[model samples]
Target: MSEQIADTAPLGHAKHIRSWGNWAALILLVLGAVVMLFPLVILALNAFKTTEDYNMTGPLSFPAHMSLEGVISFWNTTDFPMKFANSLLISLVVSVVGVLLSVLNSFALGIGRVKGNTVILLFIMLANMVPQEALLYPLYIMFKAIGLYNTQWSMIIIFTIIQSAYGTYLLSAVYGTFPQAILEAATVDGASRWQTLLRIVLPVSWPTISVLFVFFFIWTWNEYMIPMAFLMSDSVQTVPLALATMQGQHTMAATDLAAAALLSIIPTIVFFVFFQRKLSQGIVAGSVK
Candidate 1:
């Protein structure tokens, strides 16, 4: 009986330790969430408050009365609809064109296994590692020479190249591990390389490509530095650039700036919500594989 009690005592102690560990982890996670969410809470609170209310009550308190004046002021001041359209167009074009470019590059390097593929891939990776700051002057000069500076097309072209390099690097590694038997089977049935890629490789790789598309869109939307350098005209400026220009202006209020920020994030939130199911599925598929 004493021996049994001794054995059970250790088991009980282990269980107690696990319980304590779980509670500690839970507390840490909860605290971390609050820390992350606090700024967002403040933003939302101030966005709806009047300038006077925000200054009087401070950011932490609820507004005396919610008002849309700040939102309306920001919208009209920034010509937000036009900026929204510009951001959407640039993001969409970059994501689609970038993914297509990445797929083609990956196919050649990964599945085709072209001569000196490793060297080419290494060069591509090195190119991507080059900072945007380093490229700014050269890109500016080139775009100016071509008369593409201060144009939305310039941004689309630049970001497509930027986003595709990383995509190619990632997708190449994924495609390298693709099953040879499938390719052989497709060949035996008289499928051309293009057909096999379109019907088989693309379908099989859709989940990964979808995730890349979402990421590329979000990344392009948030870009500031490159856009600021390349796009000079208000007509071609994106949401981030617009917001940056609005900052610290004599005419703009803190509540109005908060409102602009709140408005700017709404599209991205909606985009994520719309694609969340597909995103989840891709994540699960990647994990299983």
Candidate 2:
């Protein structure tokens, strides 16, 4: 009876410990959520405020009344629609092309198991480690030489290569673990490598690829330094460039700067929200196998 009582005591104690651990985790998550969301909430509040109201009430306080003056000023001053179009175009192109390149490279390196693939993947991984700052001067000189400087094409090509390198490294690991039986059945059925990739590999691996697509889009959209270095023309500048320009001027009001930031982030927010379900699915699929 004493032995059984001792065993039950440890089990109850473990359950108590687990319950405390769960509560601690929950509290940490709540605090983390508040930390993450507080700035965004403040930004939204300030975006609707006027200079007078903002200065009078302060950033921590709600607007006395919603105003469009800041939003309008920011929109017109930055040529925001143009900036929005440029960012959208660049991000979409990079995401699509980057994913395609990743898929093809990963297929060869991972599924086909090509010669020297380890060396190649190592080089690709190394390329990802190289800071964009280090390559800026060379990229500028090369783009200028090719007459692509100050153009969106320069940004597109640069990011496509950059993003594809990371994607290839990741997707390669996923594909390396692919089921051999499926590939064998496809080959026995007289499907060529290209057909197998198209019909079998691509569909099976799409969840992971979708995750990459969303990441590429968001990453490209948020890029500031590369875009700023490569794109000089105001008409060609991306959303981040425009926002930076707005913030750089000492004369710009706080409310106006907040409004510009809010406007700049809206598209990305919408993009993620639209693809949220797909992103969740991709993450789950990637994790399971």
Candidate 3:
């Protein structure tokens, strides 16, 4: 009886230890989530506060009274709608153009097996590694000479070209892992290169395409430096440019700035939420091969 009791005691103790470990892990995960979310929570709360309340109260504290005055002021004083439209237009155009350019470049390098493909790819990868600031001055001079300065098209083309290298690299890696037999079969069946890419490859690579699309959209939307450099006119200012101007000039209340920042993040968050599953799958697909 004592032996059985001793064995039972150890078993119970083992179970207790495991239960404690699980609980500890759960607590830590919850705490980490809270830490990550704290800034966003603060931003949301402050958006409804008056400038006075925002300054006086702790960021974590509830507002003494809720007010939409900050949001209203932001909307009225700033060209929020126009800035949003400009950003949206720029982001969409860049995303589409960037993806198409990347796809074509990747197909040429990966499937065309063209002479000097590796050398060209290496040059592009090296170029992508160079800091943006390093190229800014030269780009400015070239754009000025071409009369592209202060035009939205200049911003679109610059972003698309700069972004294309990474996108091409990513898509090439993906295409490299695709089965060669599929390409061979298509060729044997007399399917043209364009048809094979459009029909066979793209059909199976939607996840990667979605991932690139979302990535380019987010990058272009949040892009500040390029737009700031090329889009000098107020009429051409994107959302980030407008936000920067607002903050620098102190034309908007602090609460309103917070609100604007939160608003800017909403589209990005929505895009991610909508495509999160596909994004994850694409990442996994890329990593696995």
Candidate 4:
């Protein structure tokens, strides 16, 4: 009894310390979330307010009455529908094409017996490490030469190039988990490489693909730099550019700007709401051999 009490005394003390540590970590997380979310919460509150209400009370003041007028005005000023369509088209096209290209490139590099595959993959990885700012002038000249400058096509091309590298890296990691015996069996059954890839690999790898698709979708949707640099026309402007132009000289009402920001986030939020479960599944599937 004496020995047991002695042993448990240290264990009890350690357990008490661990309990306090867990509580400390949780409190820190809560504080961090509040810090990050406070601005967004403020944005939401002000989004429902008017400029008059904003001026009369304070930025943090609860509204005397909620108003939709600012959001309506924001829609009018920004040409919201056309801007939305442009962003949607660009993001969709880029994600689809980029992810497809990544799948093919990843397969070739991850599973193929071809000579220089590692060298090629190394070069591709190096290409990914090079930042867009470094390539901007060259891309501008090339696009101008090809007559794609200032067009949506330029955004499309550049987005594909940037996104495909990351997608390839992600798919390769997941593909490395595929069973070699299964691939060999398919080859022994007289399946061509393309047939094996299409029929065998794709079916098994779809969960990872779904995750990559959504990841690329979010990245391309939020992309502002390429579109800003390339898309000069108002007709081709994306959501970020549209929202950005609302700042400065055009000088939209602060509340209206807040409203517009909230409005723009709706689609992405809906996407997450629907696919969040699948995202969890995909991540788990990719991780497990």
**Candidate 1 residue lDDT tens string, 1-289:** 9999998999988765657779999999999999997887888889999999988988889999999988998888888999999999999999999999999999999998999999999999999999999999999999999999999999999999999999999999989989999999999999998998999999999888898888899999999999989888999899988888888454678898889899988888789789888788778878877
The lDDT leader among the candidates is: 2
**What stretches of model 4 exceed 4 Å from their correct place?**
1-36
Clashes of each: 0, 0, 0, 0
For model 2, state the Cα shift of residue 170 in Å: 0.5
Residue by residue across 1-289, what tens digits does model 3's lDDT show? 9999998998888765657779999999999999998999999999889888978986778889998887776666668888888888888999999999999999888887778878888898898899988888999999999999998889898989977888998788777677999999999999999999999989888778889999999999999987888898888888888778878877677689888888778888898899899899988876775
Q: For candidate 3, give the lDDT.
A: 0.86
Give per-residue CA lDDT, model 4, range 1-289, as digits (tens).
9999999899878765656779999999999999998987888888999899999998888888999987898789889999999888988898899989999988987877447876877777899999878888999899999999988888888989788988887777667767899999998999999999999999888877878778877888888876778888889999888888787437677888889998787777677778788788888875675
Worst 10 residues of 1 by lDDT: 245-254
**Clash list (residue pairs), candidate 2:** none
What would you estimate as the lDDT of candidate 4?
A: 0.85
lDDT order of candidates, best first? 2, 1, 3, 4
In model 3, which regions exceed 4 Å deviation? 1-30
Better of 3 and 4 by lDDT: 3
Off by over 4 Å in 2: 1-20
State TM-scores per candidate. Answer: 0.89, 0.91, 0.87, 0.86
Q: Can you give the lDDT of residue 77 in candidate 4?
A: 89
